[model samples]
Target: MPEAVIRTAPSPTALLASLDPLLRQWLPRRRWFAGKGRPITGLTPVAVTELPSPAPDSDGAPGALTGLYHLLVRVHQPPAPGSPERPGDCYQLVIGVREVPPTRPAPGLIGHVTRGPLAGHVVYDALDDPRPAGVLLEAVRCGARVGPLRFDRDPGHEIRTGLVPRRMTAEQSNSSVVYGDRLVLKVLRRIGPGTHPDLELPLALARAGCARVPAPVGWMTAELSGDSWLLGVLQPYVQGAVDGWELALRELSKGEDFAAEARALGRATAEVHTALARALPTVTLGHRAMARIADGMSGRLAEAVRTVPALLPYAPGLRSAFTALGDLAGQGRTWTAQRVHGDLHLGQCLRSPDGEWSLIDFEGEPDRPPEERRMPQPAVRDVAGMLRSFDYAARSADTPVPGWAETCRAAYCSGYARVAGHDPRTDPVLLRAFETDKAVYEVVYESRHRPDWLPVPLAAVRRLAAPGPARLMP
Candidate 1:
């Protein structure tokens, strides 16, 4: 275990005041705040954990607090159907507040506080809290045995670890605080128990020497006896890089040739699939897995179609696509199921300064079960994901032109086929099936999560539905 950093003296009153207006205003505006857009009658602070100040000034004031000040806040709200009545409904907010001089030099702190629970909070960028950041890094470098983490709902599994924290830009499910640019510690807002795929699979892959992904460093778990909640994971952060999506978009926007880049990305992705197949145990692609995949897509697609009625007409076509793909199971096309990066879109890949592509985030889709994510399936699933991403890059352009998708797709498929040893010409049916399946999934995803972005996937679906050569490039 790493050496424990002594916690700073409690300054609850000052800290509370510092959090006053900001806490009140920020909650309602946040997407994960449970009570988003709803009126919070009151906020009661249930717990506070203080840590030693990172750097203390002459008068004993903390230059910054290094440890995390985890506050369990109870937010009062009206009861909704199926909503929990007890304090269980309250959200746990782990805020890393650092006491910096009113005038500190940091690039991220330039913006003033906006609205919500943090409306009036004199909050600066928490990354300014080097004390906490350092403590987190040390924990990652040298494993630490900290207190057992308990989930409010179930208290059977006891999770204890000293993992470092690194600050990251906002993501879909949680706010990530990275550690040493090596690992990302994601604190989940919408909590649940049962091993999280993000933590489980990435660790498995890294241990297996899958070069495409960031290695897992540590994890924070919440025990509930029979099941455990994966509160956070620490994985190496790929520095000096841009996600593949942004890179592709830039290439398209500037009218630059992306064939070479796309081909390289394809090769990397194929290598990942090959590694995954070799490392993990095989499973027959039977009706159960196929049904699960199909059912999952159906549920999400149905919900999305409801949210955007404009997508109603496409839902039937999308369902048919999934159904056709699902029927391919048990045809001797099964491959070993090892842990895979559930979501493999261009946005999930990063291009290092050296121009090498590195995959990040092992947590399959945010909504799927860990077992499902860990299950082995066709390697082409990942191929489809990247292909869809290529389409997205073209569609997301300010002024998309013809032929870009074809150019990139051809290059990517060519590269992947070379490494995976799959000839598109011979496997035309299988390749087209994968692409169609991905397009269907994207249509529903974009419609619900990003309405304005629906056209990207919708356009892809329309193209696939229209029928052309299976392989875009010769």
Candidate 2:
């Protein structure tokens, strides 16, 4: 148990002023930081709360030297020319303060604070420290409230305290800590108003009796300006489960066929989509809505070509795919739209030791705005993302494996059709357009981040953009 101490919330003005210089240098370097390539002009404090720390030392001395704080700060960056001015992006931060730096170097050491109430204290990311991480879980277990911050847990769930914390390193857009292999806590780095799908979707699926997703056991939030901002969520950890991406690559390297696993994954995805539809609102898109969606795809392609000259050659073929969808809509075609995984790929799935597949990370594309990510879309959109993932896995191999990706793609669609009551392949144009759009997104992302890896997605682009009767199905 932590020490019971009464600490007042730090003054917003002094807190932001003291941390401004350190954050300007530290925030962009984080893997979860979304404002890369942009200079931060300033930071404004949204809320601040003092956090609990470890109990007194063994010698009956006070542990006043250690401090923890939860804060929400809005990062200001210059928008593009002629763009309307709006509030900058807000981020959730857990900061730790100590009178002295650690004996051994640790990750997330921000630096020594030179001003404000915390002057001369060494501050680091609290998530990187075990004491602070354990405090967060304890708060959830007790539903502790600190000023504007709220930590609540589902009363039906039992969360054991004093569990060891180990931060997950593979996450790119969020920070996660696993507690004694029992629960995993995902801390949202970027925050916005309204209900976040990461929490909302999983809870909805749980209520609908969906077993394919881990239900939330606890969560943290902040009430600000009449809106609740999700700070983090806690879910049961699947012990000894391997992510689908790593499993796929291992199978590909051994020349083993992955049709069975792919089929199971497809089934799992369909189950999630069905549960979401049953538990949430569903809408049928008319001709105009379809045209607007198609236009967005076309617009993204145009932007990609402008950013990556390598995409220029395939621009015409890709444009045709989007144009086909628009033409179909122009003829009054319509389709059902329901809540989905938003972004579905091999990396977003986990396979248990017993071979059960489970979907994770419903946050969708982290780069997209929250509202856009939460929008209902055709379920085939997720199917296209997974198909592209199969191709990616095959291409990542040491040598090209002929028909490997095709077999997995076909088997996946077959499995989905069995549960969905309709074949995704039945609408070749919609699937093709979605797949093309996903490939184009990959091209842009890889070109900017990993030049050598650009060829993998570009190969898909060549095949997807091939001039033909529109390669409908795998």
Candidate 3:
């Protein structure tokens, strides 16, 4: 089959008027489109590509295109002062177009067409549009078969696919359409030239038998085409699960003792760390990496201290703690580096209905550079993250309860020590140092994004200053 000439042009209403109804159905329903909830003032098609056509249409239609087609759309919005500039805010829609017939309905395609830009364009969700879903699914499934797409961590096993494209719940950052029960296809709205951490790290962890993470089934790479698109990620669907943040809040609200559960979570995290150490090549956390981590905390602390004047009083002590930690780098008290889950907050963990915890979403902190995110760091970084979460849970409660924080901390540390074989007491100074650094990071995080939550980290900083006697574990 001759390759259709890949082309680029601005698409006006007139151009869309002549296209298939299916095309119109898809353009509006996508999450990557800027005009998701608003009217599209105008649209300019930045680029387009022709994919191999799927098998012939069942209806015997002549000259019907059945291959994957990519569209880059710039959506115009009402001008407003001080609004942050985002590609999605202007480029309202990105559609991965493909042609399919009515007879073959792709799996995972039926759902409500909620309020959004697409609702006015099409009465139903795009997956409900029979033609487009079938075309995209055929392309995804076929792409999986084309070659041995090795898992990043375990290259020995090739990726297998049985993705059925379905409409996804609305998300803020990217467009997600599930591929059957096996994988999720997340098409990024913004254009960037780096590998998405969401796709890369989870696949690496899963390949390493990090059972807590979703296994990568396949992924669609749109790099070579120069469009700066993340076609989609195919991952195993974790069934009957609740997000860990919600679960933690629920447990805390119910007056249930979470010590045992916290300990279990610690163990699960240790398992993840063990897998990471085994699967990926390790690096020593030398001066450069330590300085980078310290510098990040120091920078955020400075900004936070300035913004929330309340933090200023504690600034001197915080600076001393950070400097002491940084000084350890020169003493050769280095940590082994391994791939870590960049973002380890409660929201990133999923608890199955059976009460088992599974970590989801290996996309590290969103603000960090891709290369920095991929770089190995001390496993304790994740431990420090979870510890901070425990403190947050304690502080945000309606009434301050005695022993709640201590109990949870002990449980978590116990589980971690059991698996990682590190005694928390012996390393109390180091552990507390890392914890203080994490709290400082949160101080800035909450100040900038959620000013209301500033008290959470501020209280933590106070607690860190009053050093407590280390409790020796049996």
Candidate 4:
């Protein structure tokens, strides 16, 4: 971690100063920490706010006095290896201060200190502690406005206080707390200035009466660089919901036909896209716009090629797909562009116990900048993502299931055509290009994060680049 940039601060100086020494040690351990393997070069506080502390709630044991702090710390990463690193990422840290540490081993503990005003105090991530979680929930429920951090609640929805908060443990880039089975609060760890798409998109879908998405009931925001950056969001909890990824794996094990489920999911996706088109501004994609889109795909592919030397052979074939894209766009073909779930995959979807399919995580690709996530794109971008997900799922099984992925892919397209009035298959060029681009991205990601899974995307790259049914190579 970088050296502490601030030795002192304003309101919460005492508390902030105490945590500075431990932040570096604790941050890299969390799953949400992005700059793993890379050294953090700098650390500084961009914004800090104090949230109202509720009177300690005693559940048999003696209640300890606790202080809650909302902090936005900027973490800098060294650019080395394959790609250039972001200048830095601002992370939101919710810390709870106490005089005594937890009696048992806890992952939340920042550390015990003995050098500052908090010499004898214990600091921990507040979201992992029930006491501070209750207070944070109360703030969201009452729409408490604390300094630049404003908490707001949606109409027709109310929150209940003192519902012992339970932090969700899952493979996600954000932190989440579920309150007594009624609502779940998702805290965005890596923050970007301006309203986050996760919050902005769902609210719009809710307004459009789209039931596929869980409506936002409450949210917290802070100002960064003169624009609002979303800190956290609260929505109704999907009780007993099994995410599509798990459900698909189960089906793959059972050897059950999943084409029907895939079709229904396709229908649900179409419904969401329709609602989004009506609720948000729409634009038309001309030749120039398509050229820009192709360029972006090519750029990402180039980055992937540089990082994964294994992808170098497929680079020329991938470029051919993008080249064909520009040629098609030059033919005066224009497509409609509107808001879409920028990141759509099997993991982004959930299947409720009652047999309903719902989409989650509208944050888009967390690695991409917020501005890019907000840009209007063809709805097929999401279609291609889901299709690629199905392909990945098929390969994930111990033995690659013959025809399973193809059957589901065709069914999903047919279902989408039922509602969308146009079949995604008819536009093979766009779909192939998108799938190729997505596979390229996955190759790089898996190569970096999951070397074992790297072959999955590598197989996709070969299929997409070679002369095949789905290949778009010129």
Candidate 5:
């Protein structure tokens, strides 16, 4: 056990209670925090453990002070009227306590601690401190089991130590730190007692000999009361790689064709889907199952319309898409359901300079429950998400590129058909419903987070709801 884990001076419960006020104010503001717009009524500590310090200095001397702690706090928020009662969400936090502020200003500073175990300390998100980030990677490299936290690495890979850490800034639902171009560690902000798809899917794909996704190099987990919760994952960092979203926007700016790149991405997606089907148990969703899924989509649309009145005009058309899905089920249609990248988009993909594409971030819609995200679903759901992403990129340009999205969409489907032996366009009903569902989600997300971006998805909503036969391209 590390020295930090052995200390017992600060009671975890007491520490959490004292920091309640600061946490309530800080948690909601975080991009990763899910309970935005809802006022936090309270925070109950579920589990807390001290973390190890950074490695020794260059001369092998002692390291900095041990002020980092791993915390899982359940946040309680007042529910909306008629909403089902449920336990509050649990968020994983890495906090650092310093006697004084860092030499340079840092993010996530929650002001000085006026009370608590260390009354005179300054508290901030520990990940912003390189020392704590290095400690996490070191623990993973050594496969350390400290207190309730377990750090493990794949036996096939050896992680090098002393890599400098720089936090990634573009992430919205999780905090990722890149370690000197070798590895990137993604610390999941919201945690629950289940195997997160972010770690599980990658490992499974690696086992199935799939190279379209990065293999996990190391991971972290927490054990509390005989249950395991996934905390973080470390994977190889694709150096000199640009994400698909950025690539799309750049190409659009120069009036360049992105069909070839989109086609390759589709092939990559198909490969991942094939591997997932082989690695995990798959099922055939029959009439009842498909109907239930359609009902859920309709229910979500109803809720979204209520939340964003702007969706009202397209409600009837959107409902027709879902209705077509249910009608298919009524006609005894069945589709294969397997574990998929629950939420897929261009942003979740990385394109190397060599033009090879690799998929990342399988955590799914952060707002959805963990178990729901882990459930089996039609692979077309991912295909639909990518399609919406194409439209979004095209519309996001200063001057919307006409036919750019359509050309890319056709090329992508053709590429997928080459690998999977079937094009997603062949299932127009399922594709339209899933794409509509994705647009509805985007509408709600933009309405709440970025009103300026609302028109992008709204454009898709109008096209998707246009009265006509379901087609491959809008």
Candidate 6:
């Protein structure tokens, strides 16, 4: 963590301006900070909405704040050494002001104010304070509008406010506060414009009567300066549930079969896809789209080979996969495309005590542009991502299980075929190409971030890019 940049200001606007340089100095240092290791050109304030300070608690306790502010700040970064420049991303910030310094350091403290209305006061992240966090829930429950922000509650579900909140730690991109075990509210740290798939897909599935997802009970949004931003969302948190990644590792530790669980998860995935197809727009992928996708994959592969010299040996084999995709497009074949969990992996799923698999985190790939995430794509992309995860888990374990990942892979495809009316295995050409492309991506990612884990994906690269055709199962 970086040291907080303290500043003194006479008023709110001045406080923001004084704190701007400090925020820019601190942002790239935090783990949840997305633009880490990059130089932040500037921080642009898009909107700032003030919230009513809460009154005393029922037990007559003082509220955390006499003032609350919700901010939308756009973070700008310059282009990579050789890449083109891109647009900045918006982030949500909630700050609280108090007359006295906190007994303990606040979660997101940026230091104290030294002058004016907030003189002799301390300022910290409002969501880190229980009282102001409650205000967010209150607004959601009553469907109220505070300044430019609007909160909405699903009429079918009731709200439970005033629960103590504890911010979850060690997160990568967002901050989530678990409100007493009743609801887990995820405050999106990197605020993007328009509706996120995390909100849109679940609501659509819930309305289409799909039980494979935990629907939001309440949601919060913002319409400021002619742009809309998704702020926070509330969902019923299933207690005693373990995420699929942890569960898979646990079973692997015991040398137990995970094929059955994998099958069920595959069915759940197909069900969600079916529901999404029914609820949202579906398009027939055109030749131009296929060409573009093929070209993109080829470009990524070229870039990966340049970065990881180990990929040089497999370049020929990798080129064939993209070439095959182009061949498919040239044949005038027609394919259907629809919304998919753009970043599906074992960590993105939850397994309940009752043995049901619920897919969570519909927010697509955070690295990609939001506009691209909303576009329709082949559902096989998700299947490919999951396959890579299954392999990664087995390889990452202390005791690597032979034949285990392959068995689960086949069983999962079998289950998917049962519901989707078409086996992903049947489309060998597309499936192989997608799997190869995904493995190449993993190799690049692991090489850059976790050098020790590079061998895990490199193993797949060697196999998929071998002389024989890419094969997932018997």
Highest lDDT against the true fold, candidate: 5
Q: After superposition, which runs of candidate 3 have C-alpha atoms over 4 Å from their true positions? A: 1-138, 144-183, 186-191, 224-231, 287-289, 306-310, 398-401, 465-474
lDDT of 5 by residue, 42-142 (tens): 89988887776554334543323347888899999976322466899999998877776664427568767778685777788878877778888988988
Clashes of 5: 0
Q: Per-residue lDDT of 158-244 in model 2, one digit per residue for the tens?
A: 999779988887866789999999999999988888999999999999999999999999999998899999999999999999999
Candidate 1 residue-wise lDDT, 144-228, digit = tens: 4333343221122222334444456555656677655555566665555576767656556666787777666566654445666
Error of 5 at 299 (Å): 1.4
Clashing pairs in 4: none
What tens digits encode model 4's per-residue C-alpha lDDT throughout 98-195? 77765532538888866666677788888887766777678777676677777788868978766878888784789999999889999999997876
Task: Point to the candidate with the largest TM-score.
Answer: 5
Better of 1 and 3 by TM-score: 1
* lDDT leaderboard ranking: 5, 2, 4, 6, 1, 3
For model 3, give the 10-residue run with minimal summed lDDT: 145-154
Q: What value does the lDDT take at residue 84 in candidate 3?
A: 42
Model 3 steric clash pairs: 33-92, 33-93, 34-92, 36-117, 53-67, 75-91, 164-179, 164-180, 183-235, 342-364
Please write out the lDDT profile of model 6 over residues 111-229, one tens digit for every residue.
66665445566677777777678777777877877667878889999776567677766365677777887888888888777878889888999999999999999888998677777
Error of 2 at 393 (Å): 2.0
Please estimate how well model 6 matches the true structure, expressed as its whole-model Cα lDDT: 0.79
lDDT of each: 0.60, 0.86, 0.59, 0.82, 0.86, 0.79
Worst 10 residues of 6 by lDDT: 1-10
Candidate 1: list runs displaced more than 4 Å: 1-52, 57-68, 71-92, 97-128, 149-166, 170-172, 176-191, 222-228, 237-239, 287-292, 326-338, 423-449, 464-474
Q: Alpha carbon lDDT of residue 5, candidate 6?
A: 18
Count steric clashes of candidate 6.
0
Clash number for each model: 38, 0, 10, 0, 0, 0
